[model samples]
Target chain A: MIEIQTDPLLYRVQKPEVRERFEALKQRPVVLSVQNLYKTFESQTGTVTALKDVSFDVYRREFMCVIGPSGCGKSTLIRILAGLESSSDGKVLLDGNPVTGPGPDRGMVFQSYTLFPWLTVKQNVMFGPRMSGKRGTSAESEARQWIDLVGLSKFENSYPHQLSGGMKQRVAIARALANRPRILLMDEPFGALDAQTRCQMQSYLLQIWRNLDITILFITHDLDEAAFLADRILVLKANPGEVNEIIEVPVPRPRSAAQFITPEFIATKYRIDQLIHPDQGSPEDALPFPRMTPQGDDVE
Target chain B: MLTMFSFSLPLLAWCAVSYLPFLWHPDVELQISADREGVTTVYTPGDRVSEEFFPEFEAAVRTQNEEVSPFMSLDKPVEAGSESSVRRSNKKVLRHLAPLLVSNGWLTEEQTKDDAAIYVAWKEIATGARLPEQPALTEENLEIVRKNWALMSRYSDSYNADNFVSRPLLSLVPQGRPANPDYLPAPHRVLISGFKEFTKPAEAERPSMWQRVGHSMRIVFGGFLLAALVGVPIGVICGTYSFFSKLIEPFTDFFRYMPAPTFSTLLVVIFLANDAPKMALVFIGTIFQLILVVANTTRRLELPLLEAAQTLGANQAQLLTRVVIPGILPNLYNDLRILLGWAWTWLVIAELVGVKSGLTEFIETQGRWRNFDSVYPVIILIGLIGFFTDQILSFIRGFIFPWTSEGPAITSTPVAKVLLFVPRWFKSAVDERIPYQPESTSPNKA
Candidate 1:
C-alpha cells in the first residue's frame, strides 16, 4: 500500500497558487525516517563530531542519493541506517519499525568487493537465502534469478577473484537482493569502478530499481551521479557534517546519457556544487570552520 | 672419476686406518678379541698364554673353584723363556679346561690340545728366544687364535665374577668392519642384505623391518586423526568466541611449553601400557600446538568476510559452518601438514616408552646387536615415508583449495592427470552444501 504524490518535489519552487494546488494531491508515505542523528569520533588528538543533528526522510520506492565532500559523514549516515554501525542518538525507522541492527530487512553493498571470495558467483548470491534457511530448488532458483538479473549468467561458476571489479560489484548487488530486503543501501557501490563501467553500472542499477520497485539509498561524492540518478539529492556540509540542502530533480525519468547534456541536469549539478562550495569563485574561499580554534572553544 | 673419488673418500680413509698397523710392522699380525661381556685384548702371533692377556680368565677360575685353578696350583713356574715347562703346565691347564670349554661350544677338543702346544712353540719365536722350523702363524691364523681366546674367556663359567673387564674395541683401525663380528656392517651391506629379511616371514622374537614400519604408520595415523578431530573444532570455537579462547588458551599454552613426554605418567595412570599410551603420546605431542596454530589462523580471518556474512543474514552456527571453517581451511591444512611432521619427531619418543614394537624399537634392538645391516634401512624408511606423506598432503591441499596461492603442481604425467580428478570429488563434496544450479532457459531476464 503505497500512496503516490502528484507533486514529486517536497518543497514548492513555483508560483504560490500553482504550488498549493499541486500539494493538494496525495503525498507519498515515508519508508524510512532518520531523525536527530549524531555521530562522534574520538581519537588521540581530540573528539571529532562527524555528524551533527542530521535528519532526512526517504519515501517508498524513492531513489535518494546523498552527496557530500570528503569527511562529510554521508557514508556514516548510510552505515548507521544499515545498522552496520550504531547512531549515538536518534533512530532510523523502516516501515515504522526501529532498525536495531543489521538484519535481512536491510541489505547493503559496500564499495569494496564484499562478494565472498571463497564462493562462486552463484554461491555468493545464494549465501543469503541459504543462511536464512531457505534451500533446495527454491533458493537455487532465487539465486539464479538475481545472478541473471545482474547479467552474470555466464560467470555463475566463477569465483569472485576471477571476475572484474564491476562484475564483483554486480554479484554483491545480486547477493544483497537475494534476501528480498525492503531497502537496498549502497555505500559508494560504483566508486571503485572505472568511468565507463561506472556509467554502465548506474544505468543497470536504475533498470533494476525500476523493474523491482525497490527503494534505494545511494551514497556518492560524484555530482553528476547524484543529479542523474536521484529523485532527491541530499547535500551535506563538512566539519561536523550538517544537511545544507535537499534538491528535487524535476527531470523526467527513464533517463539515460542523452540527459547528461540537458540544461536541467547541468543546473542541478551546478546548484549542488555551489551548495557544497558556497564561495565557489572567490580567491579568499576557505573552510567555513576556522582552521585553528582557541582552547576550550565549544569543544562539543 | 671425480664423482667416484668424492664418494670413495670415506672408504679410502677407512682402508688407510685399517692397514696402518701392517705398514708399521709387516711381519706381525695383531688379533683383537672381544665378546658380549665387552672384554677385549690384543694378541700378537707367537705370543704364549702366559705372555698374552687372560689375567681376568685366570683370576675368575682361581676365585670360582680353587681346586681347578691351574694358575693357583701349577707344579712348575712359567718362566718367560721356559718353553718346556710353560708348555707342560699349559697342556695340563688345557686338559682340565677342555671339557668345560667344549661343553659351552667355545673351543673344540683338538683346538684345546694341539693348538695349546702350537701356541707355546710360537711364543718362543715371537720373543726371539727360539727359531721356528717354519712360520706357523699368519695374520689370518692369528685372527682365529684371537677368536679362540675370546671364546675361552667369555664362556668361562666364572666370567661374570669380579674379574670381568669392559673393553671397547681397539680402534687403531676404523670401526664398523664385518670381519669384526661386534662391529657395525658397512652401509651397502645393510641396504642390500638387510632388505632380504623382508622377503620372508618374521620371527616370533623380532618381526621384520617392514612389519615394524607398518605398526609405526598405524600409530601415527591414529594419533593424527584423533588430534585433528578434537583440535580443529576446539580451535574454531576458541577463535570464534573470545571468552572460549581466554578459557582454553592459558592451559593449552602452559602445557605446550612443558615437554609432552612428561604426560606419559598421567597417560599410564589413565590407560593401559599398550597401544593406548603410545597413541596418547603421539596425540599429546601435537594436539596442544595444533590447537594454538589453528586458533591463530582462525583469529586472523579477514574481517570484511565476516561482516559480509553478517549482512547476508548468517546466524552464529551458519557463520561457523559456512564461512569461518572454509575461510581457515587452507591455512589449517598447512598447519596440519607441519604438525604431522612434528608428530613424527615424537614417534620415536612415543614408541620407546612402553611395550616397544615400532621402527624405533627395532632400530634400538638391532643397534644393541651391532646389526647396522638392519638398523640403517629402517631409519631411511622412516625418512622416505615422512617425505612422501608431506608431498601427498601438499597435493591434497592444492586440490581442495584451488583458490589459494598454493596452486596444484603442474605436470603432464598420467598420475598427475589422475590426481587432477581428485578436485572433482572435492567439488562434489561441497556441491552437497551449495547445490549446483543449472543455467536458466532464458539467459537475460530481469
Candidate 2:
C-alpha cells in the first residue's frame, strides 16, 4: 500500500456539498463482496481451472480493477459475475444477496461492441429498458439521456453500420448505464480501443463515476489502465488463474494522463512489475499467486 | 437435310429411351384444341409468329405490307435514310420507357438533357463523334447520359413497328386450311387461294396480340412477386437468430440440392387437385427456393454485430430483433438473386404438367405437331423474360441497398494514417476498438 497524493481534482471541484457527500459515501459498507472465488472449465482437452480462490470486496462508489497477464482469469471472473459463464465454485454477493443469475441490477459492458446492426443507436439503447417493461415517455426520456451521456446525441438516429467503432462502444456503455445497475462489471472494456481513445473513454468513465458513484469491477491486462482508473488493483497470475496480491492505489482523486509520469507512479509500476516478474530481483519473490512468507523465512 | 437431321435427334432419343425396361413410354403429344368461336392450327414451320397465332400472324403480314412497304422499311437507321413510320414508332416506345425508368430511379437521371439530342442524332458511321460541350456538366455525367442513349437506341431496334401487330393464320382460317393436293403441308393453315375448298376460320375467332402478351406477362410477373415476398421474410428471420438458423438451415440445405423437377412432380400431384394448379405450382416452387434463401442469409450476420448486441444488455428476444435480422440484408439480396433462377427452373416443369395455359404448354402444343420453329422462339421468350425479371429484381435490390455496391468498392481498404509499415490486421483491430470522435482523443493521449 502506498500513500496517495491528494486527488488533484479536489482543488478544482467547486461543489462543497459534493466533497462532503463523497467522504460520507466512502463511509458506506461494502454493497457487494466477492470472496475466495474459483472457476474451472472442463473442455475436451482437460479441466482448465481458469480462476483460483480470488477475493475482493467492493464498497459503494468504489472503482476496483482486476489486472493480470493474459490467460489469467480476469475476464473469466467477470463472465462468471455476468452470468454468462458459471463458476466452478464460489459465490458473488450483491448488496449481501447472492447472485444466482444475471439481473438488471448488475450491468456488464463487454469488450466487443455488440450493437444490433439494424437498430439505430437510440433503439439499441432503448432495448433493455423496453424489455424490462419500461415504455412510452419514460423509456424515451431515459434513452435520450443515456445516448447523450455516452456523447452519442448526434448519432442517435444512425444505424450501427453508420457508426464508427468508438461510437458503437459508447452506445454499449450507455446501454449498460441506462439500466442504472448497482454494480458495473467491465471486462477489459477498453482493451480493444486505440491508445488515444482508450484514455478518452477512461476519463469519461471517471467523470461519469464522479456523478453517479456506482460500484465498478473492471478487468484489465494493462497495468497502466489498472493504475489510472482503479481504486485498488488486484494482480492475478497465469496457469489456473489466481490473485497474487491486492495492491492499494492511493493516487489522489482526479488524476489526469500527465500523472502517469510522476516518480511515485513509476515506483508503484516497478513494484507491480517485480511482482509479475520476480526474476528482476530475488527468486523468492516468484511464489505463485502470493502467499506471504512466515516471519523468519529466508529469501533465496 | 441439315434441318431434318437437327429435328430428328430428340425424337429418336425419346423413342429409344421409351423402349428401355426401366424407362416409361411418354406419348406426350402436345395439341391445341379449338372452340367453335376461336381458330386452332397444327404446328408447322415457315415462321413462329405466323404458325402460333394464325389470324394475328396474317394481320401482321397485311399490316407490314401496308405500313412498311416502300419507304418505311427496317433496312436503315432513322438517320441514314428517310426517317419512316417503322423508325418513328420504335423511337417513341424507346424514348418513353427510358425516361420512365430514369425518372423513377430505376435508371440514373441524366444531369443534362443533351443526351436526348445526341441519341436523336446517332448514326452507325458517326456513333463516336464528339458533340457540342457548352454546359458545365461533368464528363462523367455526360458519359452516363451518352451510355443511356446507346441503351435506348439498342432497345429501339428490337421492337419493329411492323412486327408489333402480327396476324396469325389460325385466326384467319379457323375451319382449317384446305389441303393443297400438290403441296400437302400436313401441318395446316395454308390457303391455295384459287381453290375455293381451302379452310378459312370463322369470322369470330380472331383475338388481339396485345391481349395474349398481357395475359402471359401477368402470370410470369405474379410468379416473380410471389417468390420475392415469401423469400425475403424467411431470410430476415434466419439471419436474425441462432435458434432459427439451427432449426431452418439443415432442411433448406437438404432441399436445395434435390432436383427442382422432383418438387414440381410432387407439387403437380398435390396441386393438380387444387382449383388453380398453376398458382399452386408457383407457390410450391417459390417456397422451396425461399426457404433456401432464408437459410443462407442466416450464415452472414456480421460477426461483430452479434457480439455487439450481446454487449448491449440485450435478452434473447431483443437479440433476435436488433442484431440478427438487419445484419443479413446484403446476404439476403444475394441469395434471392441466385434463387430466382431456381424458382423459374421449376416454372417450366410446373407449367408443363397438364397445363393448357402459359408459354410452356403452348411450346408443348407446337412440339406435338412438329412446329420446331415456333418451339424455339417460345423457349427463347422464356429465357429472355427470366433474364428480364432478374434484372428488375436486381434493380430493386440496388434501390433498397445503395450502399451495397459502394461498400465493397470504396471501403475494402481505408487510407492508412501512417506509412506502409503498419500491419493491416493491427489497423483493423484498432479501428474496431477506437471510438470515432475527434474530440474523444485527449490532446496528448497518443
Candidate 3:
C-alpha cells in the first residue's frame, strides 16, 4: 500500500466564530430529524446497502445542503425525507411527528423537469391547493401570488413546453411553494441547467429562502453551490453511504458573487472537495495509453 | 398545390383510360343492333361485344336479311293463319328502332313506349324527313330502313297491328365504336349515373342514397362511442395500477390478436338480423385495440409528473383524476381518432353481415349487377366521409388540447374563426363567473 499525506491547510477544524454561529442556530426549534437511517436494495447479485446509519437535524428556517459524490445516497436520503421512499431501518420526524407519506407539508422538486406539461404555469401552481380541496377563486389568487413571487407572472398562461429549462424550474419552484409546505426538499433541482442559469437560480433560491419562513434541504454534487447558499453542509462517504461531517459554513451571511473568492468560502469548498475526492491526484499515471507526444510539449 | 396534385393525379389517370380510346378499348359498343335468324339472343344498341365477334354478328344479320328478301318478293306472299305471327315479329322489329329514335332526340323517353310514335319516327327516318345528327345512320342501315318501310307501307298508311304483320321487316346491320368493357364505365358516364341515382326518388322497396349514407354514419359513430365509453375507464385503471394492468392487459393483448371480423357470424346469430349485429361487429373490432392503445399511452406518461403530484399531497383517487387523466388526455384523443378510423375498416365487413345494410350493402348489390358506375359513387362516398372526418377531427384537436405542441396553432381563417367562437365564448363566460382579477403586468423583481 502507498502512503498518502493529508493536506494540513484543509483539515477539519472549525473556527471560533463559525462554532458560535452554529451554536446559536441549534438553539432554534428542530424542523426535521433523521435517526439511524438505512436503505438497501435487493438485486440479482444479492442485497446491496445504499445508505447506512445516517443521522441529521435541521432547525426551523435552516438552509441545509447535502453534498457528496455520485453514489453517496444523496438522492435516497432526500427521497426518504420527502416520504417518497421508505427507509429500511430509520425514523424521520417532521416537527416531532413521524413522517409517513408524502403530504403538502413537505414540498418536493426533482432534478428532472416535473411540471405537468398539460397545465399552464398558473394551473400547475394551483394543483396542490386544488387537490387539498381549495376551490377555484382562492386557489387561483394564491397561485397568482406564487407565480409573481417566482417572477413568472407574465408567463402564467404558458405551458411547460413553451418555457426555457430555467424558466420551467422556476415554475416548478413556484408550484411547490404554493402548497405552503413546512419544508422544501429539492433534489439537485438545477443540475440540468447551464452554468450561468445554475448560478442565477442559486441566487434566486437564496432570495426566496430569505423572504419566506421555510426550511430547505437542498441536494447537490457541486461544492461551490453548497458553499454559496448553505448555512451548513452535510458531506457523506460512498459505498454504503454514511455521514462524513456536518460543517458550519464559515462564509458570511447575505452571500453575493463577490464573496465566492473569500478565504472562508474557499476553505469550506476545499474541505468538501477533500471529503468527496480523498484519493485525488494526477490520473494520467493510471491510464494504460502510451505517450505519443514530442518531448517538452506539455499542455498544463 | 401539392394537395391539388394529390387528388388530380388519380383523376387524370382515370381520364386517360376513359376518353383516350387508343389506350385500351378491347371491345366494340354497338350503335345499332340486329337479330339473328333462329337465335333468341337480342343485341341492343348499347351492348358491347369483343372486337373479333362484331363482324360475325353483322354477317349473320346480313345472311338472315338475304334469306327473307326472296320469300317476300314472291307472288303468293302470305298464309292467313301465320299472318298474325308475322305482324308480331314486325312489331318487335319496329320497337328495336325506339332506342335509336330516343338517342336522336326525335322521341322522348316516354314516347319510346308508344308503338304508334315509334312507327311514325321510323317512317320519317326512312323518308329522310328527320335526320339524326349525334349518331347519324350509316348508308347501309338507311338502305335497310327504307326497304323495311316500303314493305310496311304496302300494308298500312298508319300503324295497324293486323296490317303490320303482313310481311317480315329487314333487320339493321350491327355497327359499333371501340370501347372499354361494361364493368369499367367512363368517368363522365359514372358522373351522370351517380347524379341520377342520388336524385332518383325512393321506391317502395328501395332507400335513397342519402338514407344509405346516414345509416353508415350511424353504425360507425355508434360503435365508436360505445367502445370509448367502456374502454377509456378500464384502460385508465389498467394504466394506473399494476394489479389491474396485470389482470386485464394480458388477456386484452391476446384478444386483440384474434381478428374482429372472425366473430361476425357469431354476432349475426346473437343479434338476429338487424343493425345490432353490424354495430356489434364494429364495437368488437375497435374495443380491444382501444383499450390496449389507451393503456400504452397512459403508461408512456412520464413518472416524474406522478411523483410530483404525490409529493404535493395527491391521494390515489386524486392522482388518477387530476394527474393521470389530464396527462394522458391529449394522447388519448389522438389514439381515439386513429381507432375511429380502425372502426371504419370494420364498417364494410360489418355491413356485409346480417341482412346487408348501409352503403356497403348498396355497393354489394350494384356490383353484383355489374352496374359499376353506381358502385363507384357509394365506395367513393365512404372514402370521402372517412377522410374529411379524420381531417376535421385533427383540426379540432388543436382547440381541444391547446397545451399540446404536436399540431399547428389554430389559424385565423374564416372557418377557423367560426369554429373558435364557441370555445372562446365558453372561456369568457367562465372567466366572468370567477371574480378575481389579476394585475395585467406585474414586474419581476427577482
Candidate 4:
C-alpha cells in the first residue's frame, strides 16, 4: 500500500516517467529539513504561539513558496529557516548541519530595502565577499559580475539612496547572491512594491532562480504568486499557526507570467485554495465571510 | 521678500536714528594740539579768539593728556592779535579758573575780582604763596589740582563752542584727530602703539594681539584633541554595550552638573602649574558633555544595520569600524563642532588657571589698563576665528562623509582623499586575515 499511489489526480496530471523522476529527486538529498518546529513570543501580555508543530523538507535547487493568511506565521517560518529566529522546539538541519543562528551559508532578502545606504551599489554587492575576506582585483570583478547579472552594471557607483525602489531591491538581491549561498530566503521581497513593479520583479526573480540553480524558500500572502512561482506550496492555518498541507504543483517548468491564465495553473491554485478554506465554496463563488480550513493530521 | 523686509526694518531704523543727525552737522572739526613737554591742549576753530590768547585754557580742556602744565600768569597773556581783545578774553578765562583755584586754597574768596583780580592771584600762587590754613603741597594733591584744572578746561571749552549738543556723531566715533588728546583720546589714539614714546613700556612688553590669539587657538586645539581621544571611545563603549552605559551614566550625569571651572584647583594639582593645567581645564570642561552627546548619538544608530553586518560575517570590531562608527560619524561631527565652540568659552576660564599669555589673558590685562583699543579687536578676532573654524569643520565633514545628505560633499585635497581611502585599506586588511575560498565556476553564468 504505497501512499503516493492513492493520489490519482497527481498521477493523471504528471506522466509516470516524470513522476518517477520527481520521486527519485525527492530521495536524492534533503538540502533543508524542519522537524516539529515551534515558536512562542512572550511579552508583558500572555505568551502567543506564533508557530506550532511546523515540519517540511526542501530538496536541492527546488523553488518552494509558503503561503498563509495574515498572522499565520508564514514570515516566522521563513525567518527560522534563515537562522534569524530560533525555534522553541525541534530543530532545523541545513545539509545535515543543525541550524543555530544567522551565518554566511544562507542569504536572506527582507521585505524592507536593507541595502546599506552608505555603500554604492557595487560596494554593497562586494560587502559579503569583502567581509568574508576576499579582496583585490578578483573579488572586485566577481562583485561586478553579480551587479551586471542583476542588470545594475551602469549603476555600480550610485549610492542606495540614489536608486529607486525596484532598483534598490535588485541591489539587495545582488548583494545576497554575491555570497553564493546554497539557499536564498526571501521574506515578502516584493510586498512593498506597486502592482506593476511587483509583477516585473516576480518575473525577474524567476529568471534569476532559473539561472542561479540555487534553492529558494519564498513567503507570500498572494495565492496567485505562489501558484505561479512555486514548485511546491506550503499552506498554513492561523491562530497558533501550523502547517495545513504541502501541495506539489505538477506544471511544466521554464514558465512565465503568461502561464498564470492556463488551466493547470488555475487547477493547482484551486486545489491550494480548497486546502486553505475547505469549508468555503470555490474562489469564483467566494463567500464574504472569512475562510477557515479544517485541521488535518497531515504530516510527512 | 516681505518677511526679509520686516526682519530688517528695526536694524535700519537703529542705524538711521543713530547717525542721521551727526551727518547733517557742518564745521564740526575741532583740532586738539598738545605741546610735547607741557599739558595737552585742544582748540576749536569756532573759538579762535580764546584759542589765540588762552593757551592755558587750551591745555586744560584736553582731559586724557596727563602731561604736567607750566604755571603761566594771566597778567601776561600771549602776544597774539590785539592787546585789548587779549585782555578781554583773559577775563573770560579768569571767571572759569577762579572757582577751581578758590576750592584748592590756591586763592582766597576775598581775593576774587570782577576783572583783573584772577590775574593778580595767579601771579601770587605761581610765585609759591600759600594760605594760612592751607595743607602741604604733596605730589598727590598737585595731581588732584591738575585733574580739576583739566575738568574746568573741558567745561569752558564746550560752553564756549556752544555747538556741543549738536556735535557730529561721525566725528565722535573716537578717532584720534577730531578729539582732545588730553580728554578722551579717540579710540585710534589708544590703538596707535607705533608712537611708542606715548605708550607705557609695560604695554610694549606683551606680544602682538594676533600672536596672543594664536596662543589661545593652540590651547583650545590641544584640549579639544585630548577630549575627543578620550571621550569618543568612552561614548562608543557606553553606547554599544548596556553595562558600560549604566556604569558610566551616573558619573557623566553628575559631572555635567558640576561646573567644569570648579575643577581648576584639582586640575592644577594633577597637571601641575603650566600649560597642562590650563589645557586640563578646557579638557575637563568639554569631555563630559562630549561623552554624553556622542553616547546618545551612538545609541540612536539603527539596530537592523548592526544585525545586517553581523550576518555578513563581521566580527565585533569590524561591525564597529565599518558600520557603527561610520553610521554615527556625521551626527558625531556635528556634536563635536558644537562642543568645540563650548571649548572656546572654556578658553577664558582655562587661561585663568596658570597661563596668562592667551587672548583672554591679554584681554584681562588690557582691560585693567583700559586700553580698550587693543581689547575690542582681540574679542572680535576670537569671534571671527570661532566662526571660521566652524565653517571649515563643516566643510571638511562634507568632504569626508559624502554619503550623508548633511555632508553631501566630496574630497579634492590629497590629504582628505588619503583619509577617505583609509576605510578601503582597513577593509582590505580585514579581508587578508579571513581564509579565501576559491569559488566554483557556476554553469549559471550567462
Candidate 5:
C-alpha cells in the first residue's frame, strides 16, 4: 500500500491548531450514521451499482459537505439520508432510531425552487407543521418565526410566483426549517442560483447554521463552497461511487469571502480539486477536430 | 367598440335584407283577393303569389265579375234549394273586405270572424263612412262593394244571417305589392311576432316562453353539475395515482369514443320518457370527456409540488387533500368550463330523444311550421344564454383563482370584495385566536 503522506495529491496543508479543533468536533455525538450503504438501479442493461460501501457520520450540530465529480452518487447518497430513496443494503440511523421513510425529524431542501406556487410564503412554511397536526394560529405563529429566521418576513404573504428566484429559495429554506428537524438534508440547494446570489446564500447559510442547533449534510460539487462552509468535507469518486477521503477543512471559521484566498482555504480546495479531477491533463490533445483558425501566436 | 361592432354587423345585415323591398322580393303579398268560379283553392288577402301569376289572377276575377253583373241585373230570385250555398258564397265575398277594413283600424280581430259585423262593415265602406287610408280601395273594388251593398240592403238595413242576400256578390280584382317569401319575413314582422309570443299567456296546455327558458336552463345546469360532481373526484384519483390511472383511463378512453348520442335509445328505455333521459344523455355526453380532461389536467400538476409535500411529512390523505387538490384546482376549473360547453352541444339531441321539452322542442315545432319569425327569437335566446354564461364564468374565474397569472389582478370591486370576504374572514378569525405574546411581537424586525 502506498503511504498517504508521501503521495503528492494526498498532501494537505493545515493550521497548527486544526488537529485540536478536529478532536473537539469528533467528541460531539453522531446525529446521523450510515453503515455500509449500497444502492443499485436496474436499468435495461441489468443491475448497475450507483453507490457501493458508502458510510459516514454527521455529528450533532456539525456542518458537513459532500463534494464529488459528476455521477459520483452524491445525490443518491443525500436522497437516501433524506429518506426519499431506500438503500439496497445497510442502514441509516437518525440519533438512535433507524430511518425507514421521510419524517419530520429530517428536513430537506432541493436544488430546484420547490415552494408551493398556490400558497403564500407563510403558508408554505406552515405546511410541515400543519401536516404534523399543528393547525390554526399556533402553526401560523411558528411559521412566522421561521420566516423571520430566513429574513423573509416582509414577503410572508406574497405567493411563490410573486417572489424572485433568491426569495423563493429563501422561502423554501424557511419551509424546511419550520419542521424543527434534528438534521437538515440539502441536495445542492444553491446549485441553480447565479454566482453572486450563490455566494450570498452560502454566507447566509453559514450564519443560520451558527445560530441554530440543527445539523446539516449539504451536497455540492463546488470545491470552494465546500471549503468555505464545511467543518469537514467528504469527497466521493465515480463509477460505483465510494468514499475517497474525508478532509478536515482547516480554514478557521467566522469565514467570509475574504478568507477564499487564505493559505488554509486554498490548500483545502486544491486537495479536493486533485481528488475530483485525478487525471487532469491537456484536454485539447484528445480532441480530433481539425483547427480552422489562422495559425497565429496572437490566439493564445 | 369592437364588441359592439361584432354584434351590430350581423344586425345590420339582417336589417338590410329585410327592409330593402327592391332587393329580392320574388313574390307579391295580396292586399285584395278573389275566388275563381270552378277552382277549389280560395286565395285570400295576405296570401302570396309569384309576380307573374298576379296579373292572370286579377284578369280571371275581372272576367268572372263581368259575368256576375249581367246575371245580377236579370234579378233572378234565388231558389230555396240553393239559398244556403248562395249565402255561403256571398259571406266569402264579404270576408274579402275584412283584411282591408282591419288594416284601416275600422274592425277588431274578433270582428273579422263575425259575419254580422262584416256585413255592417261592408255597408259603412260602400257608403264612404269608413275610408281605408293606407291601402285605399281602388275605384273598381269600390264599385263592386257599392253594387253588392245595394243588393244586400234590400234584404235588411242591418246584418241578419237568416235574411242574408242569397245571390253571389261580384268579386273584386286581385291587388298586391312585391314581397319576400313567407319564410323570410321582414324584421319588424319578426319583432312583432316575437313580442306576441313572449307576452302571450299560457293558453290551456301550452307553456309560456319564460317557462321554456327556465326548463332549458334546468336541463343544462342539472346535467353539468351532476357530471362535475361525479367526474371530478374520479379524475383527481386517476391523476394522483398511476395504479388508478392504468385501471380507469383505458376503459374511459375506449368509452369516450363510443359516442354519447348512440346511447340515447338505451337511456330513454332505462330512465323512461321524461327529463331524466334527456339529463342522462347530457351527463353521459359530458362525464366521459370531463374525466379524461380533468385527469390530464391533474397529471400536468408539477411533480416537484408532490415531492415537496411528501418530504414535508405529509401522509397520503394530507398529500391529496392539501397539495394535489389545491395544486390542480385552477386548471380543473378551466377544464370544467370548457366541458360545460361540450355538454350544451348535446342539448338539442337530448331534448329530442323522448318527450321533447325546453327551447329545443319549441324550435323544432316552429321550424316545422315554417314560422321562422317565431323560431328566430328562440334560437337567438339560446345563443345569448350560452355566450353570457361563458363570459360570466370567465370573469368570476379571476376572483376565484387570484393566484394564477392567467387571471386579472384582484380588484376592490364590490362583487369581488363580497366573493373574497369569506376566505379572508376565516383566515383572520384563525389569526385572532392566538394568545398575545409580547416577545414574539414585531417578528419582521428579527
Candidate 6:
C-alpha cells in the first residue's frame, strides 16, 4: 500500500456516500480514554522509550487519528488500546474500564496481509466468527454478506495470495467488521499498498466506517492524512514520545483530494505544517487550521 | 550432483583400472622365442580369432619361432616319440585329462572323448612343432596348427600355465586319416576372465555370486512390495489423524533407531520357540522397518495440504481416505525408496545372524574360506541388484510424482511443493517436514 507513507489508515476524505453513511450509522454508546500511557522496549542496547506520558479521550463513535514521525510509537499506542500489547505504565479505558487482552469486543486490522494465505478471501473475512467456533454453514453465509458489502462477492473464493494488496486489506477490514466489534483498531493497515491502491483503499475504508458507526482508532504518519481523515488529530513528537499538539481541519463534512487545491484546505494544511515544523513556518506558510488543547478546548 | 560425483569417482577409477588391460589386450597376446632367433607371436586360441581377423595384430607379431613340444607338463620333461604315437599320446592326454580340466574350468559337462584332439592339435602348433599336416600346412591343418600354437603360447612363461600341478610329453601325428577327426579341446576357454566370469551356478551350491543377487532381488522386490502393502494404510491413518500417529509414535520412535540387527536378534529370541525362526526374524525385521517408514512419512504428510482439508472441516475419516492418502501417496512411494534401502540393510543384517542362506550368508561363508573370488562377485551382484531396484523405485516415484517432473506442485508455494514431493532422504531437510509416499508406482510391475 504505497500511500502508507502518506497516511497509513487515514481513509480518503472524499465520497458523498461516506458522509451519507456517517449520518446514517447508529453510533455505539461507548467512551474511551488514554490516561498517561507509556511504553518501552527492552533491547540489547537497553530500553528505548516509545511512548511517554501520552494522554487523550475519545467520545462514542468519534474518529481519532494518531499521527507522528516514522517509528514514533503511534502503533504502540494503538496496539495498547486494542489490547494487542500491554502498556508498561498507563491505562486505556473503554466504556470506563481498563482494556486488557484481545477479545471479540475490539477487532484489529494489522498492517500486514493477515488474511491467512491458505484460506480464501471470503473464508478470511469469516475467520473471526469461525474462530469464535460457531458452525461452518452459518459462518459461510455470514461471510457472504460481508463479502457482498465489501463489493468483493466475485472474489469470495480467491485466496489472499491471489488478490492484490488492496484487495487483501479490504478482506481484512471486512473480517474485522464481521465480528461486529464496538471499536475498530486499524494499525496503519494501508501501509503496505502501492500509491494508487492506497488511495482506493482509503476511500473504501471511509465508506465502510460511515456505514458502520464503529469507533475507529486510526494511526498514521502523513500529516495531510491526519487532516483529511480525522475528526480530531493527535499529533505526537518522537523521543520520549508525547502528544505535541492537536489540530482540527474545520472543513465541511464531505471532502475530496480535489478540495486539496482550495484556499481553505491549503490554509489548514499550513497550520499542520507549522505545528510539525515550526522553524520552516515562513513566507511558504499556507494552510490554516485551529490548534486544539489537551483540555479538549480551543486556544482562544 | 556434486555428492554423486563424490561417491562415484573413486569407484569409476577402480573399474577403469580393473578393466583397462581388457580394452588394450583382449586376447592376452604373448610372444614366444625358442632359440632366441626371433620372437614368434601368438594369439588366444578361440574360433573368435578365426572368425574375426586381427590383420594388424597378426602382422605386428609376424616373426619366426621353432620348438618341438606339444602339451605342457607342469613339472616334468616331455619325451619325444614317433609322429603317430606322439599324436595318439596327446589325444589320450586330453581325454584322460578331462577330470583335471573340469576342475580347472578348461572343460565342461558336454565335453567328450573326441574333443581332446582339438587341444592336442592346437597344442602342437603352439609349441612351434613342425607338424606333418602343416607342410607344410593345409588350410585345414594350418587352422588347427595356428590354434595349437595359440594354446601353447597362452601358457608361455608369462602365464606359467604349465603350473597345472603336473604335465606330460606330446606327439604330433602326421599320418592320421584326413577325412575324420578323433578328439579336440572344448570349443572355448572355460577358465573365465580375471576369475570374475564364474557361471550362474546351480541351486544346491547357491554360489556366492548368485546368492547376493538372488537374495537382494527377493528383498528388493519383496521389501518394496511389502513396504507398499504396509505403508499405504498406516501412512494414510497417521497422516490423516495426528492421534493414530501419536498412538504409534512412541513405538516407532523407540524402534526406528534400535539397530536392525538388534531388532532381528530380539525377534529371534522372542520367537525362537516358533517353527521357522529365520523366517520369523525376517518378518519381524521387515515389519519394524515398514512401520518406521509409515510413521515417519505419516507424520509429515504435506501439512499444508492436510491443513487445507482440516480447515475445510473434513472429518478425520475423510481426511484419511481422500486428502491424506491421495495427497500423501506420492510420498509413500518415496518412502518405499528409502524403506527398501533400509529394509535391504536390515535384511542383510537379519540374515547375518538368524538366517543362513541369503547373500549375506554367502559372503560370510566365502569370507570364512578367504575365497574373495567368490565373495566379490556376490558383492558386485548385490550392487547391481541394488542399482536396478533403486531405478525401479525411482521409476515408481516418477509416475506417482508426475506433477513433480511435469507441472507445478500440488501446493503453490515452492517450499510446500518441495515438502509434498521430494523424498526425505533426498531432501535437504531445510524444513521440519519430509515428503514421501509408500507405494509401487513402478511402471514395470505395479
> Best by lDDT, which number?
3
lDDT tens digits, residue span B272-327, model 5: 99999889999999998999899999999887777778888999999899988999
Which candidate has the top score in TM-score?
3
Better of 2 and 4 by TM-score: 4
What is each predicted model's overall lDDT from 0 to 1? 0.71, 0.59, 0.87, 0.70, 0.85, 0.57
**Candidate order by decreasing lDDT:** 3, 5, 1, 4, 2, 6
Candidate 6 lDDT over residue span B166-275, tens digit each? 22232222111111111111112112421443455555655545445565456445644654576557655665567887787568667656555555566668766332
> Which digits, one per residue and each the tens of the lDDT, describe model 4 over residues A3-48?
2222324414776765775786697578889989999999789999
Off by over 4 Å in 3: A1-15, A136-139, A244-248, A263-271, A283-300, B37-42, B51-98, B110-131, B137-171, B201-204, B257-273, B411-446
> Number of backbone collisions per candidate, in order?
0, 31, 1, 7, 0, 41
The positional error of residue B1 in candidate 2, measured at the CA in angstroms, is: 44
Q: Tell me the spans in candidate 6 whose CA falls farther than 4 Å from its real position.
A: A1-31, A267-300, B1-109, B112-446
TM-score of chain A of each: 0.86, 0.82, 0.91, 0.87, 0.91, 0.80
Candidates, DockQ: 0.24, 0.11, 0.41, 0.23, 0.30, 0.08
Q: What is the lDDT of residue B349 in candidate 3?
A: 91
Q: Predictions ranked by DockQ, top down? A: 3, 5, 1, 4, 2, 6
TM-score order, best first, reads: 3, 5, 1, 4, 2, 6
lDDT of 3 by residue, B332-389 (tens): 9889999999999999998998788878888888898999999887778889999999
Better of 5 and 6 by DockQ: 5
Candidate 3 interface RMSD, angstroms, 1 decimal: 4.2
Q: Which ten residues in a row have the lowest lDDT in candidate 6 chain A?
A: A1-10
Tell me the tens digit of each residue's lDDT in model 2 across B204-294: 5432323434445555446656767876677666656567777876787776566645655566677673324555555556666676667
